[model samples]
Target: MPSAHTKSPRAASRTPLIEVTKLSKVYVNDAVETPVLFDIDLRVQSGEFMAIMGPSGSGKSTLMHILGFLDRPTHGKYRFLGKDTAGRTDDELAIIRATKVSFVFQAFHLLPRATVLENVMLPLLYHPTIPSAERQHRAQAAINAVGLFERTNFLTSQLSGGQKQRTAIARSLVTEPQVIFADEPTGNLDSVSGIQVMGALEKLHASGHTIILVTHERSTAEFADRIVHILDGRIASDSRSHSRRSSSGLTSLK
Candidate 1:
Protein backbone atom coordinates (compact mmCIF):
# COMPACT_ATOMS: atom_id res chain seq x y z
CA MET A 1 0.00 0.00 0.00
CA PRO A 2 1.10 3.52 -0.64
CA SER A 3 2.08 5.67 2.30
CA ALA A 4 -0.30 8.30 3.67
CA HIS A 5 2.01 10.96 2.23
CA THR A 6 1.28 9.84 -1.29
CA LYS A 7 -1.03 12.11 -3.22
CA SER A 8 -4.55 10.80 -3.55
CA PRO A 9 -6.34 10.50 -6.89
CA ARG A 10 -8.66 13.33 -5.92
CA ALA A 11 -5.78 15.55 -4.93
CA ALA A 12 -3.97 14.69 -8.13
CA SER A 13 -6.92 15.98 -10.14
CA ARG A 14 -5.81 19.54 -9.51
CA THR A 15 -2.19 20.52 -9.76
CA PRO A 16 -0.65 21.61 -6.50
CA LEU A 17 1.75 24.52 -6.43
CA ILE A 18 3.98 22.62 -4.02
CA GLU A 19 4.01 18.95 -3.01
CA VAL A 20 6.06 16.76 -0.72
CA THR A 21 5.74 13.04 0.04
CA LYS A 22 7.42 10.95 2.69
CA LEU A 23 10.08 13.63 3.01
CA SER A 24 12.85 13.16 5.53
CA LYS A 25 16.09 14.91 6.43
CA VAL A 26 19.06 13.80 8.47
CA TYR A 27 22.53 15.11 9.26
CA VAL A 28 25.54 12.86 9.70
CA ASN A 29 28.69 13.89 11.50
CA ASP A 30 31.50 11.41 12.22
CA ALA A 31 29.03 8.64 11.35
CA VAL A 32 26.67 9.93 14.07
CA GLU A 33 23.22 10.41 12.56
CA THR A 34 20.72 12.98 13.81
CA PRO A 35 17.32 13.12 12.22
CA VAL A 36 15.43 16.39 11.87
CA LEU A 37 12.33 15.53 9.81
CA PHE A 38 10.50 12.29 9.26
CA ASP A 39 7.87 11.03 6.81
CA ILE A 40 6.38 14.41 5.95
CA ASP A 41 3.68 14.89 3.35
CA LEU A 42 2.22 18.24 2.40
CA ARG A 43 0.70 20.21 -0.44
CA VAL A 44 0.07 23.90 -1.05
CA GLN A 45 -2.26 25.42 -3.59
CA SER A 46 -1.70 28.66 -5.42
CA GLY A 47 -2.76 31.89 -3.71
CA GLU A 48 -3.22 30.18 -0.36
CA PHE A 49 -1.80 31.50 2.90
CA MET A 50 -0.47 28.63 5.01
CA ALA A 51 1.37 28.80 8.31
CA ILE A 52 3.61 26.15 9.83
CA MET A 53 3.81 26.65 13.60
CA GLY A 54 6.22 24.97 15.97
CA PRO A 55 8.49 25.75 18.86
CA SER A 56 12.24 26.08 18.44
CA GLY A 57 14.04 22.89 17.31
CA SER A 58 10.78 21.33 16.11
CA GLY A 59 12.06 21.29 12.47
CA LYS A 60 9.72 23.96 11.11
CA SER A 61 12.60 25.99 9.70
CA THR A 62 14.13 22.90 8.15
CA LEU A 63 10.85 22.12 6.44
CA MET A 64 10.71 25.70 5.21
CA HIS A 65 14.20 25.39 3.76
CA ILE A 66 13.28 22.23 1.91
CA LEU A 67 10.09 23.74 0.61
CA GLY A 68 11.88 26.93 -0.46
CA PHE A 69 14.47 24.91 -2.43
CA LEU A 70 17.33 26.15 -0.25
CA ASP A 71 18.05 22.60 0.98
CA ARG A 72 17.25 19.14 -0.34
CA PRO A 73 15.72 16.33 1.65
CA THR A 74 17.85 13.30 2.40
CA HIS A 75 15.00 11.08 1.19
CA GLY A 76 11.54 11.22 -0.39
CA LYS A 77 10.08 13.41 -3.07
CA TYR A 78 9.51 17.12 -3.62
CA ARG A 79 7.67 18.72 -6.47
CA PHE A 80 7.44 22.42 -7.25
CA LEU A 81 4.85 23.65 -9.71
CA GLY A 82 4.31 20.08 -10.89
CA LYS A 83 7.99 19.38 -11.64
CA ASP A 84 9.79 16.70 -9.65
CA THR A 85 12.93 18.21 -8.07
CA ALA A 86 14.92 15.14 -7.04
CA GLY A 87 17.72 15.13 -9.60
CA ARG A 88 17.83 18.79 -10.65
CA THR A 89 21.34 20.28 -10.78
CA ASP A 90 22.45 23.21 -8.61
CA ASP A 91 22.27 25.64 -11.51
CA GLU A 92 18.80 24.39 -12.35
CA LEU A 93 17.75 24.76 -8.74
CA ALA A 94 19.22 28.24 -8.64
CA ILE A 95 17.23 29.20 -11.69
CA ILE A 96 14.05 27.90 -10.08
CA ARG A 97 14.88 29.70 -6.84
CA ALA A 98 15.49 32.94 -8.65
CA THR A 99 12.44 32.81 -10.89
CA LYS A 100 9.79 30.85 -8.98
CA VAL A 101 10.31 31.31 -5.24
CA SER A 102 11.21 34.14 -2.85
CA PHE A 103 12.03 34.05 0.84
CA VAL A 104 11.95 36.47 3.79
CA PHE A 105 13.98 35.56 6.87
CA GLN A 106 13.44 36.65 10.47
CA ALA A 107 16.61 38.70 10.34
CA PHE A 108 16.29 41.46 7.79
CA HIS A 109 19.08 40.85 5.24
CA LEU A 110 18.97 44.22 3.57
CA LEU A 111 22.21 45.94 2.60
CA PRO A 112 22.65 48.62 5.30
CA ARG A 113 24.31 51.13 3.03
CA ALA A 114 21.83 50.77 0.17
CA THR A 115 18.73 52.91 -0.20
CA VAL A 116 15.38 51.11 0.01
CA LEU A 117 14.98 51.31 -3.75
CA GLU A 118 18.42 49.91 -4.38
CA ASN A 119 17.90 47.06 -1.93
CA VAL A 120 14.57 46.19 -3.51
CA MET A 121 16.16 46.25 -6.94
CA LEU A 122 18.88 43.77 -5.99
CA PRO A 123 17.00 40.69 -7.18
CA LEU A 124 16.58 42.06 -10.67
CA LEU A 125 20.34 42.50 -11.05
CA TYR A 126 20.63 38.73 -11.58
CA HIS A 127 18.53 38.81 -14.75
CA PRO A 128 20.47 40.68 -17.39
CA THR A 129 17.63 40.02 -19.81
CA ILE A 130 15.41 42.54 -18.04
CA PRO A 131 16.11 46.10 -19.16
CA SER A 132 17.31 48.57 -16.53
CA ALA A 133 14.21 50.73 -17.00
CA GLU A 134 11.88 47.79 -16.43
CA ARG A 135 13.84 46.72 -13.37
CA GLN A 136 13.48 50.18 -11.80
CA HIS A 137 9.77 50.23 -12.64
CA ARG A 138 9.16 46.85 -10.98
CA ALA A 139 11.23 47.81 -7.95
CA GLN A 140 9.25 51.03 -7.48
CA ALA A 141 5.98 49.14 -7.83
CA ALA A 142 7.04 46.60 -5.24
CA ILE A 143 8.14 49.32 -2.82
CA ASN A 144 4.77 51.02 -3.29
CA ALA A 145 2.98 47.72 -2.67
CA VAL A 146 4.62 47.42 0.75
CA GLY A 147 3.67 51.03 1.60
CA LEU A 148 7.28 52.21 1.45
CA PHE A 149 7.30 54.30 -1.72
CA GLU A 150 8.07 57.51 0.13
CA ARG A 151 10.99 55.88 1.94
CA THR A 152 12.54 54.52 -1.28
CA ASN A 153 15.47 56.93 -0.98
CA PHE A 154 16.08 56.27 2.74
CA LEU A 155 19.07 54.11 3.65
CA THR A 156 18.16 50.74 5.16
CA SER A 157 20.23 51.49 8.29
CA GLN A 158 18.08 54.56 8.94
CA LEU A 159 14.81 52.61 8.85
CA SER A 160 12.96 51.22 11.84
CA GLY A 161 12.67 47.48 12.43
CA GLY A 162 9.20 47.42 10.88
CA GLN A 163 10.34 49.51 7.92
CA LYS A 164 13.35 47.27 7.42
CA GLN A 165 11.12 44.22 7.28
CA ARG A 166 8.86 45.93 4.79
CA THR A 167 11.89 46.70 2.64
CA ALA A 168 12.87 43.05 2.76
CA ILE A 169 9.37 42.12 1.70
CA ALA A 170 9.65 44.58 -1.15
CA ARG A 171 12.83 42.86 -2.26
CA SER A 172 11.00 39.54 -2.30
CA LEU A 173 8.19 41.03 -4.34
CA VAL A 174 10.48 42.54 -6.98
CA THR A 175 10.77 39.09 -8.48
CA GLU A 176 7.01 38.52 -8.77
CA PRO A 177 7.61 34.98 -7.58
CA GLN A 178 4.96 32.26 -7.60
CA VAL A 179 5.64 31.23 -4.01
CA ILE A 180 6.98 33.10 -0.96
CA PHE A 181 8.31 31.60 2.23
CA ALA A 182 8.44 33.89 5.28
CA ASP A 183 10.34 32.64 8.31
CA GLU A 184 9.28 34.48 11.48
CA PRO A 185 8.65 37.72 9.65
CA THR A 186 7.53 39.60 12.75
CA GLY A 187 10.00 38.04 15.15
CA ASN A 188 12.00 41.19 15.77
CA LEU A 189 9.30 43.87 15.81
CA ASP A 190 7.30 45.45 18.60
CA SER A 191 3.58 44.67 18.81
CA VAL A 192 2.52 47.69 16.77
CA SER A 193 5.23 47.18 14.19
CA GLY A 194 4.43 43.52 13.94
CA ILE A 195 0.83 44.38 13.25
CA GLN A 196 1.92 46.69 10.44
CA VAL A 197 4.07 43.95 8.93
CA MET A 198 1.27 41.45 9.20
CA GLY A 199 -1.07 43.92 7.55
CA ALA A 200 1.33 44.19 4.64
CA LEU A 201 1.48 40.42 4.30
CA GLU A 202 -2.28 40.15 4.48
CA LYS A 203 -2.60 42.67 1.70
CA LEU A 204 -0.20 40.66 -0.38
CA HIS A 205 -2.22 37.49 0.20
CA ALA A 206 -5.43 39.28 -0.67
CA SER A 207 -3.91 40.26 -3.97
CA GLY A 208 -3.35 36.58 -4.88
CA HIS A 209 0.17 35.80 -3.65
CA THR A 210 0.83 32.31 -2.28
CA ILE A 211 2.37 32.71 1.20
CA ILE A 212 3.91 30.06 3.45
CA LEU A 213 4.78 31.50 6.87
CA VAL A 214 6.61 29.88 9.78
CA THR A 215 5.87 31.46 13.13
CA HIS A 216 5.67 30.54 16.80
CA GLU A 217 3.13 33.16 17.77
CA ARG A 218 -0.50 32.05 17.61
CA SER A 219 -1.59 35.59 16.86
CA THR A 220 0.73 35.74 13.89
CA ALA A 221 -0.22 32.27 12.66
CA GLU A 222 -3.90 33.18 12.83
CA PHE A 223 -3.41 35.45 9.83
CA ALA A 224 -2.97 32.48 7.53
CA ASP A 225 -5.89 30.64 5.92
CA ARG A 226 -4.53 27.30 7.13
CA ILE A 227 -2.24 26.33 10.00
CA VAL A 228 -0.11 23.22 10.31
CA HIS A 229 1.28 22.33 13.70
CA ILE A 230 4.64 20.58 13.89
CA LEU A 231 5.85 18.59 16.86
CA ASP A 232 8.94 16.47 17.43
CA GLY A 233 9.89 16.48 13.74
CA ARG A 234 6.45 15.46 12.49
CA ILE A 235 3.16 16.96 11.58
CA ALA A 236 0.79 17.04 14.55
CA SER A 237 -2.25 18.68 12.98
CA ASP A 238 -3.35 20.47 9.85
CA SER A 239 -6.59 22.46 9.69
CA ARG A 240 -8.21 25.32 7.90
CA SER A 241 -8.70 28.50 9.88
CA HIS A 242 -12.19 29.68 10.85
CA SER A 243 -11.16 33.30 11.08
CA ARG A 244 -13.49 35.59 9.22
CA ARG A 245 -12.25 37.57 6.24
CA SER A 246 -14.42 40.16 4.58
CA SER A 247 -13.95 43.28 2.52
CA SER A 248 -13.76 45.22 5.77
CA GLY A 249 -10.84 43.16 7.19
CA LEU A 250 -9.75 39.98 8.90
CA THR A 251 -11.54 39.20 12.19
CA SER A 252 -8.93 37.25 14.10
CA LEU A 253 -9.71 34.72 16.81
CA LYS A 254 -10.19 36.14 20.28
Candidate 2:
Protein backbone atom coordinates (compact mmCIF):
# COMPACT_ATOMS: atom_id res chain seq x y z
CA MET A 1 0.00 0.00 0.00
CA PRO A 2 1.08 3.54 -0.70
CA SER A 3 0.75 6.47 1.71
CA ALA A 4 -0.14 10.03 0.81
CA HIS A 5 2.20 12.91 1.57
CA THR A 6 -0.58 15.51 1.69
CA LYS A 7 -3.88 15.26 3.49
CA SER A 8 -7.06 14.70 1.48
CA PRO A 9 -9.43 17.60 1.08
CA ARG A 10 -12.35 17.80 3.49
CA ALA A 11 -15.86 17.44 2.10
CA ALA A 12 -18.20 20.39 2.04
CA SER A 13 -21.37 20.18 4.10
CA ARG A 14 -24.33 18.09 2.92
CA THR A 15 -23.02 16.29 -0.11
CA PRO A 16 -21.93 12.72 -0.67
CA LEU A 17 -20.38 11.29 -3.79
CA ILE A 18 -22.11 7.98 -3.21
CA GLU A 19 -24.96 6.85 -0.98
CA VAL A 20 -26.53 3.41 -0.75
CA THR A 21 -29.36 2.36 1.53
CA LYS A 22 -30.73 -1.11 2.06
CA LEU A 23 -29.11 -2.27 -1.13
CA SER A 24 -29.66 -5.89 -2.12
CA LYS A 25 -29.17 -8.09 -5.17
CA VAL A 26 -30.62 -11.43 -6.23
CA TYR A 27 -29.80 -13.67 -9.14
CA VAL A 28 -32.31 -16.25 -10.31
CA ASN A 29 -31.10 -19.29 -12.16
CA ASP A 30 -33.05 -22.48 -12.91
CA ALA A 31 -35.98 -21.11 -10.94
CA VAL A 32 -33.84 -20.73 -7.80
CA GLU A 33 -33.34 -17.22 -6.50
CA THR A 34 -29.89 -16.72 -5.01
CA PRO A 35 -29.22 -13.66 -2.95
CA VAL A 36 -25.91 -11.94 -3.35
CA LEU A 37 -25.70 -8.67 -1.43
CA PHE A 38 -28.11 -8.12 1.42
CA ASP A 39 -29.22 -4.82 2.87
CA ILE A 40 -25.96 -2.98 2.31
CA ASP A 41 -25.68 0.61 3.50
CA LEU A 42 -22.68 2.60 2.38
CA ARG A 43 -21.56 6.18 1.89
CA VAL A 44 -18.46 7.52 0.19
CA GLN A 45 -17.39 11.10 0.61
CA SER A 46 -16.10 13.19 -2.24
CA GLY A 47 -12.51 12.45 -3.24
CA GLU A 48 -12.31 9.44 -0.96
CA PHE A 49 -10.51 6.26 -1.95
CA MET A 50 -12.46 3.12 -1.02
CA ALA A 51 -11.68 -0.55 -1.50
CA ILE A 52 -14.02 -3.54 -1.41
CA MET A 53 -12.57 -6.85 -0.28
CA GLY A 54 -13.95 -10.36 0.02
CA PRO A 55 -13.24 -13.94 -0.89
CA SER A 56 -14.53 -15.56 -4.05
CA GLY A 57 -18.34 -15.92 -4.14
CA SER A 58 -18.61 -13.41 -1.30
CA GLY A 59 -20.55 -10.97 -3.52
CA LYS A 60 -17.96 -8.19 -3.53
CA SER A 61 -18.03 -8.13 -7.31
CA THR A 62 -21.80 -8.00 -7.30
CA LEU A 63 -21.74 -5.03 -4.96
CA MET A 64 -19.18 -3.36 -7.17
CA HIS A 65 -21.41 -3.80 -10.19
CA ILE A 66 -24.22 -2.09 -8.32
CA LEU A 67 -21.96 0.73 -7.23
CA GLY A 68 -20.63 1.22 -10.74
CA PHE A 69 -24.14 1.36 -12.21
CA LEU A 70 -23.26 -1.67 -14.30
CA ASP A 71 -26.20 -3.43 -12.65
CA ARG A 72 -29.20 -2.39 -10.60
CA PRO A 73 -29.99 -3.55 -7.08
CA THR A 74 -32.99 -5.69 -6.45
CA HIS A 75 -34.14 -3.51 -3.57
CA GLY A 76 -32.56 -0.24 -2.55
CA LYS A 77 -31.95 3.38 -3.34
CA TYR A 78 -28.70 4.73 -4.69
CA ARG A 79 -28.07 8.44 -4.68
CA PHE A 80 -25.21 9.67 -6.75
CA LEU A 81 -24.46 13.36 -6.24
CA GLY A 82 -27.83 13.77 -4.53
CA LYS A 83 -29.83 12.35 -7.44
CA ASP A 84 -31.72 9.10 -6.92
CA THR A 85 -30.67 6.62 -9.58
CA ALA A 86 -33.45 4.10 -9.02
CA GLY A 87 -35.68 5.33 -11.84
CA ARG A 88 -33.02 6.53 -14.23
CA THR A 89 -33.23 5.06 -17.69
CA ASP A 90 -30.36 3.20 -19.30
CA ASP A 91 -29.57 6.25 -21.41
CA GLU A 92 -29.48 8.45 -18.33
CA LEU A 93 -27.16 6.03 -16.56
CA ALA A 94 -25.01 5.87 -19.65
CA ILE A 95 -24.75 9.65 -19.69
CA ILE A 96 -23.66 9.78 -16.06
CA ARG A 97 -21.19 6.95 -16.56
CA ALA A 98 -19.71 8.60 -19.62
CA THR A 99 -19.30 12.07 -18.15
CA LYS A 100 -18.65 11.45 -14.47
CA VAL A 101 -17.30 7.91 -14.02
CA SER A 102 -14.40 6.06 -15.61
CA PHE A 103 -13.36 2.45 -15.19
CA VAL A 104 -10.17 0.42 -15.28
CA PHE A 105 -10.25 -3.34 -15.41
CA GLN A 106 -7.88 -6.15 -14.39
CA ALA A 107 -7.03 -6.68 -18.01
CA PHE A 108 -5.73 -3.76 -20.00
CA HIS A 109 -8.79 -3.30 -22.24
CA LEU A 110 -7.02 -1.25 -24.82
CA LEU A 111 -7.68 -2.03 -28.45
CA PRO A 112 -4.95 -4.34 -29.69
CA ARG A 113 -4.21 -2.41 -32.86
CA ALA A 114 -4.62 1.08 -31.52
CA THR A 115 -1.70 3.16 -30.37
CA VAL A 116 -1.54 4.16 -26.72
CA LEU A 117 -2.50 7.73 -27.54
CA GLU A 118 -5.36 6.58 -29.73
CA ASN A 119 -6.62 4.24 -27.08
CA VAL A 120 -6.55 7.01 -24.52
CA MET A 121 -8.35 9.27 -26.94
CA LEU A 122 -11.19 6.79 -27.41
CA PRO A 123 -13.18 8.03 -24.41
CA LEU A 124 -13.28 11.54 -25.77
CA LEU A 125 -15.14 10.30 -28.81
CA TYR A 126 -18.29 10.11 -26.74
CA HIS A 127 -18.04 13.73 -25.68
CA PRO A 128 -19.48 16.03 -28.29
CA THR A 129 -18.29 18.94 -26.18
CA ILE A 130 -14.63 18.33 -26.88
CA PRO A 131 -12.88 19.15 -30.14
CA SER A 132 -10.54 16.71 -31.82
CA ALA A 133 -7.40 18.75 -31.04
CA GLU A 134 -8.39 19.11 -27.39
CA ARG A 135 -9.03 15.40 -27.18
CA GLN A 136 -5.58 14.63 -28.48
CA HIS A 137 -4.05 17.13 -26.07
CA ARG A 138 -5.88 15.60 -23.13
CA ALA A 139 -4.88 12.11 -24.21
CA GLN A 140 -1.23 13.14 -24.45
CA ALA A 141 -1.38 14.72 -21.02
CA ALA A 142 -2.91 11.58 -19.56
CA ILE A 143 -0.24 9.43 -21.16
CA ASN A 144 2.39 11.76 -19.77
CA ALA A 145 0.87 11.53 -16.31
CA VAL A 146 1.49 7.78 -16.36
CA GLY A 147 5.04 8.33 -17.62
CA LEU A 148 4.29 6.92 -21.02
CA PHE A 149 4.43 10.03 -23.17
CA GLU A 150 7.19 8.66 -25.37
CA ARG A 151 5.39 5.41 -25.88
CA THR A 152 2.13 7.06 -26.85
CA ASN A 153 2.65 6.02 -30.46
CA PHE A 154 3.36 2.39 -29.67
CA LEU A 155 0.67 -0.24 -30.13
CA THR A 156 -0.62 -2.17 -27.12
CA SER A 157 1.13 -5.30 -28.34
CA GLN A 158 4.45 -3.49 -28.46
CA LEU A 159 4.40 -2.47 -24.81
CA SER A 160 5.46 -4.48 -21.78
CA GLY A 161 2.89 -5.61 -19.23
CA GLY A 162 3.54 -2.62 -17.02
CA GLN A 163 3.45 -0.24 -19.93
CA LYS A 164 0.18 -1.68 -21.18
CA GLN A 165 -1.38 -1.30 -17.77
CA ARG A 166 -0.09 2.23 -17.56
CA THR A 167 -1.73 2.91 -20.89
CA ALA A 168 -4.96 1.55 -19.49
CA ILE A 169 -4.63 3.87 -16.51
CA ALA A 170 -3.98 6.75 -18.87
CA ARG A 171 -7.07 5.86 -20.86
CA SER A 172 -9.16 5.78 -17.69
CA LEU A 173 -7.90 9.18 -16.63
CA VAL A 174 -8.07 10.84 -20.00
CA THR A 175 -11.79 11.48 -19.56
CA GLU A 176 -11.13 13.53 -16.41
CA PRO A 177 -13.94 11.80 -14.56
CA GLN A 178 -14.98 12.69 -11.05
CA VAL A 179 -14.82 9.06 -9.93
CA ILE A 180 -12.96 5.96 -11.08
CA PHE A 181 -13.88 2.31 -10.58
CA ALA A 182 -11.10 -0.27 -10.77
CA ASP A 183 -11.79 -3.99 -10.51
CA GLU A 184 -8.95 -6.30 -9.52
CA PRO A 185 -6.53 -3.84 -11.03
CA THR A 186 -3.44 -5.84 -10.21
CA GLY A 187 -4.83 -9.34 -10.52
CA ASN A 188 -3.21 -10.08 -13.86
CA LEU A 189 0.18 -8.50 -13.34
CA ASP A 190 3.55 -9.80 -12.17
CA SER A 191 4.80 -8.49 -8.82
CA VAL A 192 6.83 -5.70 -10.38
CA SER A 193 4.09 -4.74 -12.80
CA GLY A 194 1.48 -4.92 -10.08
CA ILE A 195 3.47 -2.57 -7.92
CA GLN A 196 3.80 -0.14 -10.78
CA VAL A 197 0.06 -0.22 -11.49
CA MET A 198 -0.72 0.23 -7.81
CA GLY A 199 1.63 3.17 -7.71
CA ALA A 200 -0.24 4.75 -10.59
CA LEU A 201 -3.55 4.24 -8.78
CA GLU A 202 -2.13 5.79 -5.63
CA LYS A 203 -0.96 8.77 -7.60
CA LEU A 204 -4.45 9.21 -9.03
CA HIS A 205 -5.96 9.07 -5.56
CA ALA A 206 -3.41 11.56 -4.30
CA SER A 207 -4.59 13.97 -6.97
CA GLY A 208 -8.08 13.95 -5.42
CA HIS A 209 -9.95 11.51 -7.61
CA THR A 210 -12.66 9.49 -5.88
CA ILE A 211 -11.68 5.83 -6.42
CA ILE A 212 -13.38 2.55 -5.63
CA LEU A 213 -11.30 -0.58 -6.07
CA VAL A 214 -12.78 -4.08 -5.89
CA THR A 215 -10.12 -6.60 -5.02
CA HIS A 216 -9.57 -9.61 -2.78
CA GLU A 217 -5.96 -8.77 -1.98
CA ARG A 218 -5.38 -7.26 1.47
CA SER A 219 -2.36 -5.38 0.23
CA THR A 220 -4.45 -3.76 -2.47
CA ALA A 221 -7.18 -2.89 0.04
CA GLU A 222 -4.61 -1.08 2.14
CA PHE A 223 -4.27 1.58 -0.54
CA ALA A 224 -7.78 2.86 0.08
CA ASP A 225 -8.90 5.34 2.69
CA ARG A 226 -11.65 2.86 3.61
CA ILE A 227 -11.95 -0.88 3.13
CA VAL A 228 -15.43 -2.44 3.13
CA HIS A 229 -15.27 -6.17 3.69
CA ILE A 230 -18.12 -8.37 2.49
CA LEU A 231 -18.95 -11.99 3.23
CA ASP A 232 -21.93 -14.12 2.26
CA GLY A 233 -23.46 -11.01 0.70
CA ARG A 234 -23.24 -8.88 3.81
CA ILE A 235 -20.85 -6.21 5.02
CA ALA A 236 -18.46 -7.82 7.48
CA SER A 237 -16.35 -4.76 8.32
CA ASP A 238 -15.52 -1.31 7.19
CA SER A 239 -12.04 -0.05 8.13
CA ARG A 240 -10.54 3.34 7.47
CA SER A 241 -6.97 4.14 6.57
CA HIS A 242 -4.83 5.78 9.25
CA SER A 243 -4.46 8.96 7.25
CA ARG A 244 -8.15 9.90 6.94
CA ARG A 245 -8.77 10.80 10.54
CA SER A 246 -11.15 13.68 11.29
CA SER A 247 -10.53 16.58 13.68
CA SER A 248 -12.86 14.96 16.22
CA GLY A 249 -10.81 11.74 15.99
CA LEU A 250 -13.28 9.81 13.85
CA THR A 251 -12.04 8.08 10.72
CA SER A 252 -13.89 7.26 7.50
CA LEU A 253 -13.33 3.50 7.61
CA LYS A 254 -14.39 3.14 11.22
Best by lDDT: 1
* Estimated TM-score for each candidate: 0.91, 0.89
Q: Which residue pairs collide, candidate 2?
A: 240-253
Give the distance in Å from residue 136's predicted Cα in candidate 2 to where it truly belongs. 0.4
Q: Give all candidate RMSDs, comma-separated.
A: 4.0, 6.3
Of candidate 1, the 10-residue stretch with the lowest lDDT total is 1-10
- For the record, the alpha-carbon RMSD of candidate 2 to the native fold, in angstroms, is 6.3
Name the runs in model 1 displaced over 4 angstroms. Answer: 1-12, 244-254
Report the Cα lDDT for residue 2, model 2. Answer: 24
lDDT of each: 0.86, 0.83
Tens-digit lDDT string for candidate 1 (123-181):
88875466778988999999999999889999999999999999999998888899889
